[model samples]
Target chain A: MAPTFTTLGYLTAGLYTASLACYLRKLFAEGKWAGRAATLLLAAGLATHYFALLVRAYSIHSVPYQDLYGSTSLLAWFLVLTYLGLELIHGERAMGAFILPLVLLLLMLDFVATPHAAPAAPARGSVFALHVTSNILAYSAFTLSFVYSVVYLVQDRLLRGRRPIAIMWRLPPLEDLERMARSGVWVGLASLMVGIGFGMVVDRQVTGAMLQFDPKVVISFLILGFYVLYLTVSRSPAWRGARASVLCVVNYFAVVFSYTAVNLFFSRFHRFY
Target chain B: MSVYLLGVNHRTAGVALRERLHFSLEDGVRAGESLRRDGLVDEVVVLSTCNRSEVYSVVAQGAAQPEGGLERYFCSFHSIEPAQLNGCLYHRRDRDAVEHLYRVAAGLDSMLLGEAEILCQVRETYLAAQRAGLTGPILNRLFQAGLEVGKRVRAETRLGAQAMSVASAAMKLAEQIFGALKNNSAAVFGSGAMGAKAAQQLRSRGIGRLWVANRTPEHARELAARVGAQWAPWEKSAELLAQVDIVVTSVAGSEWSLTREALAAAMHARGNRRMFLIDLGVPRNIDPAAAGLYNVFLYGVDDLEEIVEQNRQARESEVPRAEAIVREHVEKFAAWQSGANAVAALADLRRKLRLQREIFTDAHREELAQFPAEERERILRLMDELVEDLLREPSERLMKDREVRERAVLLRDLFGLNAPDSSRRGGE
Candidate 1:
């Protein structure tokens, strides 16, 4: 079963890579067929990735978010979902070349790290499962926001520098990139708020306390605060374009620290295999 | 009989020559009717646009070529000397003609690559010929196929996606700055041709609340009415600039029309909302320094040229793909024409066989009068069976065998199976 899941994981990654190639081809060429094929391939990869997650959960006899590898895989899956959702809504696929590689990297990491799965920790109930799932989803949304902000900045630089390249034509319009990033931030902030709410509930039930000063908790709040600040600043026209994009990028780093550094070396209550 | 296309385009002829040879709708109708009536061509459709004038026709096989062909007919109808028009005219016959028509309809052959006006011109030409009672089955099928090819190329390739003109490029830049123009208001300063074109493009893009302002109030009002936009006074540029999300200026002068200070004040009034300014004038209209302000995007004529060049290159790169599509359709049309010819040949052969049987039977009627009616009927049926058996192998070969397919016209001529009906000669 583990071998089968591993094969599925590899197949999913391979499909995503193929989709990325098709998108890149479309960016340079002028054919609708390439864009359509890329989209179909990406959706296929997402299906296989979902199946792999289900199989992993079944094999381990628990939700797949019990450890670092499983949670990262879930995060990668949500990232693809968010991106695909945006693509469908906007009918824009040029950004897929920039975005799908990040998803593939996370999935590859999951594939490599899951083989050395550590011993299972004590069982956590549905509340803890929900909390972890929402938190990972929030992180996924923030990652997408990070990608859009980076694209927005690149487009801004190209337009301002008056050094337009072939890729400039393929990138989404600057306004569209900014709007997509703002939408991602909204998703991220809302999910983070809900996830933290559930986290507080679980902490109260398990430790008979509401606010345990865990390092992960502290960093999660910091990440949430940064995004909230970004949202606030984005409403003002003066802080809207480059300034807002920069702040979004900065918030993503805090997200990285919370998801990785705090999980690996700092947090006690949230430490996992 | 085969289809032929003869014409000159911007590449092959100068504007002076093209204008002299240009055909209006009435002129095309007259030419098509005269050509068909004179038996110079079996069917005709004349496509005339600013960039090209093409005449598509079907002529009889083995017709008198030099004295009464399409070229001489075109020259005589237009009262132009054949020698003078010789250098400008190009001729494509049969499959090549079909391919040329498709390419023209698809905009691949336009002066500006992927421009769409030629398609509409072709459609109108076809309809005009049709209304004049000049089109037959062959020409009809060809024009329909050309139109479909045009639509497919546009949908399947990005050939028609980019803007090739400065006016359109400015609109594209505005779209990049503001995602959807549907909610954005735009103001066009100066009622010159370029500014008017930019306003028209913006209106076509569904920009809301378009305002036209010019140094001359009458020109501004006229331009605004023409494009269905509101006219604003030139002195109200500050208020208009603050209200509109986009501003396009094409006013000509040595001095600046919109300085940075005025724009800054407008920006401040609008709460620093994102604004796109396009200056298409010489010596500059909008101050270039305004680009440095936050949330303000400014582009001049030179900046738009970069986009136009990029778009041109992109369209040029897609030429090969568009050509491939044209080639595929041309081949399909050739195959269909082959099948059509084969069908015509088979029908002719059957008709000839029936005529021969009737003549032989009529000649032997006296001898058959000696026998009973039933016996005569059996004898006639036997003769019919023999004819069917004798022709079966050749009929199947005509449809299937490529080597035999080329002999279809020869067989038709050998059997003297030419239709007495001139209408069928035009097409089915």
Candidate 2:
């Protein structure tokens, strides 16, 4: 039997929850096996989440990100997927404790919003799907960047303080966190740029206009400006590390606002719900 | 034969006594060979480090007895008086010796808990002993098990995983900023002891470029030459600061050598590249406020010490886990040791049983001569089967039982199967 989107989403939630538990245990425990277990569980969760999205897309006969519930799930999936890649590259699993909870939170929100999703004609066309998918993917990337920034601040504070925080050693180095965050932003920025480009094409095709004053479009451009400014000033000596991290962190909130409030109320053509 | 250990470590002796008792590699080889030649031990390995000097050996059961003799030999080899080792030297035998060596190799017995150097030292000593032909089956298995214990403890616990010294802490912090120092440059602001140590550490890390600057050009040049670094003029601090990714200052005096404003200016010139400042001076060479500057990471001696303490605590926290891993490996080695000993005992049992069969056959030779040759051969074959059937269960039990060693010993005693003395048998 074909699984419903809600069922698949719940399955991902369970896996992510278990993965989060392993990560938390790893933080307080001395055993490296916990870290390995956590990464494996997260990878398993990511696989399940991907399969869930495919099932949703198959059942609906359209891309999964066409609706708010599915879009949130996709975003959660991308966040974990990106984090797994970073964890693999860095060979650090401590960050998973921080990243997986956000993933679970998004999944929870998806579960809450799933029941309210109305039956409607599935959104069609590859460009529109590309527009939505890339935008969500960018948001996922930025979310990870924000988490890294937060960790960077905590590590910096811990390093600066007189007392030695027990968990501080487990956290990644301040510069490593910053680098990971920067990579997150760059990947996000590039993805967002592509999303916007596709959005423009979709706009022109649908409305016979080259541009629109849609609130989502404007706010995305503003988010783009925030990251562009971040990338530019972060290279400068006076603003590179902590200041740059703070900038990206604040920019991520702007991304959050645009993804939530702007999409819900103000954005006209960009509303998926 | 079993493992035996005699040693003096930081816990039991002062540095003067330890140094007096210390052995170089040549000394270790000589000692191992002399002990083996003199029939004191069948096999031997000497583990000597700054904190401790230990001799691990495989001696015949009960031979290392009167343990004072081994202690006296150790003292005499180093030309130290037995009176000097009074209450300072320790001795362990059999399982205790096995556990002690495991603990030492795993760094639990280190002066600094979980220090990694001992593991390498242990490995080197074992390899040296092997190269010198000082080890046999028993010591070979024991040292192999010791190395395995070290690796398992390291892999399974957080012990030896964190930087526990000030210099190491500084390197850790630097690595935090620059993932790998091989691509980064550093400048040391003084050529004093602290500065020299910092410069040496930076060079060891393979920093791309290093600059040593001091008030006296000669001192700076000497320090630079020692570390393969460039000697920068003391006046060129700003230019050095502008170019280097890291700055370590240990300049003397109450006056700040690198002030906030100067660092701010350097930051501007470098276009705000990230910089790490390690202040190892008593009076503090860099301004405390410079840490507030963008991309400038400033750490003082206190901060580094804090990191070291934290690391120490972290390593300390893993002790129970590391000990558990050590215990697990020790038990495993014990099982294998017993099994190995049992294999020998089992062979002896088979030999004794066959001897008994041969005796019975010789006794029946006159009776067999009266029967036909073929009938006599069949009767002999039947007697062989009877002996095999009688001994099969005990033989299998000796190999498979949990108390195989005990059973083997019991069997040897009951059958009067006295094996050859281990002293004559050497390591096996």
Candidate 3:
């Protein structure tokens, strides 16, 4: 018998996500550490999340991408990992202020999206691992970028208004914000490139492949295209601060549409998963 | 008596005008002497830096006598018209003069706020004037307070570090894009303070090719060559423009020396290599439009101010520590300056008692120390007690009151007492 991911799965993920969001809010609002206790709680949640994902994957003897429940669990894990990667790149523990709450929300949605798990079993096909990983990786990158864009927007607004966002003054300087936005976009672009490549590879192999002109795939490509344009504008047009922010926000929602609109609501092509 | 500070600064005058009015160290000593001989002032200290030429002095305690003596004296010293100096003059009396000195020393009255060296320069000039027997009790008290205030402003505010001087900031922007500037080439187009500072920066960063091209070629050529570069003659800058990496232009504000056409032509001639043009000149010697050229960076004072403002904001977060340092400096200065004033009262009381003793000795018709030993001891003890009693009040007043501190010069002047001069005979 495997140690199945319980409600703790959602709590662990949701707690970290919530903590990050609160920290970001505090950073912008007060420009100071709001709660070390909350930070510790989020760290604990991340640990528990790692354990849960590992246990479930071990019991199933696969990457845990078979049923909807496994997919939800994997999404939560990918989000946290993406967040930590972003933190490492930018030395921005503040993004966790926004990132962890999101992870927690997704974990809670895990409860709503997939209640009880079926008996432990290997994924239906090899492509299952490929499809699941690529989608979440790209989606997580998109999410992180959106966070950066939001901060950039807030900072930009404050600068223009000759005021401070109060909380954001604690985040980073304007240059640092610009650097963050650029870094986030770069990560997103890389993630989209890899995820799209893997999608094509797995589509050719998996039967009734999810990427068969599916709306999800279409939306994902659209999301990728948006960010590509974002990069272009940033480089050539010097689309800075505000303009980059808009692209980030729009791309984020495109990600949400790809995952939710094509998964739970329109599951025609992804029915195999 | 009002203190007066009338002078041309970097802002009000172009470099040529400023230089013409600027007094060298020798000129400064001579100017002080002339002011003394002409009875233009009772106490005079001339601050003739590149940015400003100020005369901090005490006038008769009334409206300037219309003999035009001070004006004539300055005219004779500079060999400039009284009318020409009139438009450049700003007359401040008493408190305003005191405030002006303090603010200048604090870098508040500077072209760039809170510059570090000006305060020390003011201190040095004040000390020199004192040594020259120019500064009396009033000037001494005023200058000491000003120096302390300077330290306070520099410490308590972001004025020192956050105030990115036009020269240094242009250097910083270059460093930002190029990383370390050790391998960079910086061209200085003016031989003024700002240009000199920029040159110093280039030298400090190990800049391999430094160019100091000024209208006055002789001014900074030695400096340029020492920094491992040849002096680019003012007219030859176009030929050499394509050769340098960074161009710092601070030529006279009215001149269009580093025009867009010239810099662009240089860029094109250099095969479109990246060049950073920093215009420290107020009127913008390098055209703002030049920044649009590919790989060309152009920035003026306003742009540098933007950086300063941003730095100031970040500095806001770090100000508490700086304020603490400033507060400590303020207290230290206040203590010493006030203590010096109090010591004057003690000296006065001691002098008066000694005078009385001399009178008694004459009546007794004995040697000074030959009075009955017991009587002499008693007299000395009475003198000590009287001086201490007199000093206690002034000391307590100085320690307890800001009003006294603010009016220290006037108070000292009124009492005909002085903080024993720091440089002369050891203070009592």
Candidate 4:
């Protein structure tokens, strides 16, 4: 069962790599076949990733996000799922080349870490579960926002350079990339706010204190502040486009720190097996 | 029998002379009917477009020379003198005629190489000639072959896949910027032909709102009504500038210009929303300096020309592939035509043999009267058997070998089988 889970995981990652290749092909070529191929491959990867997680949970007789490996795997799956939804909604796939690399990186981290059996941890209440779910959703949306922001900058640069290269035609226009990046931030901010509220409730119930000053908790709030400031300032006419895109890209750094360094190395209570 | 083409295209004639030769759909059908009715051609089809006017016809082997006749008739019909078309008229005969029509249908012969409009024009002209009863088996097969060539070229090559015109490039740029034109608005300055065309292109893309303004208010109103758009006062161009996502200016000799400062102010007023400006005017309508402003993309005639040149180069690379496809189809058409000609020649030979047998019996009728009626019938059956034996080898060779089939015309001439008949109308 464990080998089956590992095989499926590797297959999902391989499909994602292939899907990203297709998108990159589309970026430099004039054809719809590549775009269609990319979308189909990405969808297949998402389905396989979902099935792998389910298999792991079934074999362990517990939820999959009990440890850092399981949670990072869950984050990668959600990131792909969210990006797929965005592709479908917007009818755009050029962003896939910019996005699937982060997904692959997350999977690489999950696979390289020591494989562990299901943790025999204390039971988590409904509030703790909501906290984890919201945080994962927030992180997934922020990752997508980061991808959109980067694409926005690329598109902006191409437009500024005024070169009629094939890839410039493939990328979404500046206005569209800007709008998607902003929308992603709005959704992430809402999810993160709900996630923080749930975390506070769970923290009070578990440690009898609403505030723990854990590095992860402090960085999470800091990430929340950075995005809150981004959304507010981006709405202004003077700072709406390139400046806004730059801010979104910058804010993702704080999100990365909160999710990786603080949660993995510094947080005591937030530690997973 | 031969296929002949007579026409003047953009390559041979200037626009003034080309337009004179141009025919409306109705006029084309009439011209075809008149030519056929005059016994100039056994079958005829006329193709008239903005760039060229062509008369494609299948004529009897020794029919009246249609090239000179068509040239005179074209000039007379358009109330011009024959001398006016002396250097402009071009004539193609036989296989050359067939290949020319294929090239035209495939858009290789168009002014703008690989334009899609030529294919549709060719189709519509063929159908109209068909409807007018002016096309017979030869002309029918020729036009059908031409249409097949068009479809194959489009399918096998990317010749007509890109935007190769200024208006089309503008629309492509708009799509890139707005992602979807359905939610974007655009304004057109000046009611000139280019501006009107761009406005129509935008509307056809389902642009959210379209505003038309010109120096002449009534002209603006009329153009707006034509495209089902709103007409704004020319003075209010600045206000419209702040609202629309796109601006196309083709106002000729206009003193007014959208300066960098004014456009910057508009960008500020519109919350820094991106704006695309296309200046199609010759002397330049919009300020070139405005292109440097953030969120403002301004393209003049030169920039649009650059895009068109890029597309043209891309299309040019596919020309060899397109020509290869056309050459393949042309060969297929030639083979089918060869088989048809061979069948006709064989039929003509059979008819001539039967006629000779009848003449011999008539001349010897009295002497044969001495025989019984059954014996006479047997003699006729023997003649028929000899004719069949003589034709069997020729029939097999003609149908089975392309080289032999192509000589059907020479065979007809060698056997003195050149009497005027439908078989004489077979394509050579």
Best by the DockQ measure = 2
Residue A137, candidate 3: C-alpha displacement in angstroms: 1.6
Over the stretch A210-245, how does candidate 4's per-residue lDDT look in tens digits? Answer: 888888888888989999998898878778777888
Q: Where's the lowest-lDDT run of ten residues in candidate 4 chain A? A: A158-167
Clashes of each: 0, 3, 20, 0
**Model 2 chain B: worst 10 consecutive residues (lDDT sum):** B419-428
Ranking by lDDT: 4, 1, 2, 3
* Full candidate order by DockQ, most accurate first: 2, 1, 4, 3
Point out the higher-scoring one by lDDT: 3 or 4: 4
Off by over 4 Å in 2: A1-45, A84-94, A114-117, A122-124, A162-166, A169-173, A236-238, B13-40, B59-88, B131-133, B238-243, B255-273, B289-295, B356-384, B404-407, B418-428
| Colliding residue pairs in candidate 2 | A237-B271, A237-B272, A237-B273
Candidate 3, superposed: residue stretches over 4 Å from native: A1-45, A54-80, A86-123, A142-211, A221-256, A262-267, A271-273, B1-188, B202-221, B226-247, B257-278, B286-428
lDDT of 3 by residue, A25-88 (tens): 5554332344554566666776887777777777767566555666666776777777666565
- Quote the lDDT for B116 in model 2: 85
For residues B256-278, write the lDDT of model 3, one tens digit per residue: 55667887788777765457787
* lDDT per residue (tens digit) for residues B239-315 in model 1: 99889999998988876578889999999888777888888989798778888887888888888898888878877
Q: Indicate the worst ten consecutive residues by lDDT in candidate 3 chain A.
A: A160-169
Enumerate the candidates' DockQ scores in order. 0.45, 0.49, 0.04, 0.33
Deviation (Å) of A121 in candidate 1: 5.1
What would the per-residue lDDT of candidate 1 be over residues A119-138, giving only the tens digit for each residue? Answer: 67557688888898888889
Q: Identify the runs in model 1 with alpha carbons over 4 angstroms from their true place.
A: A4-48, A88-93, B8-38, B63-90, B127-134, B185-191, B209-244, B257-271, B286-290, B349-383, B412-428
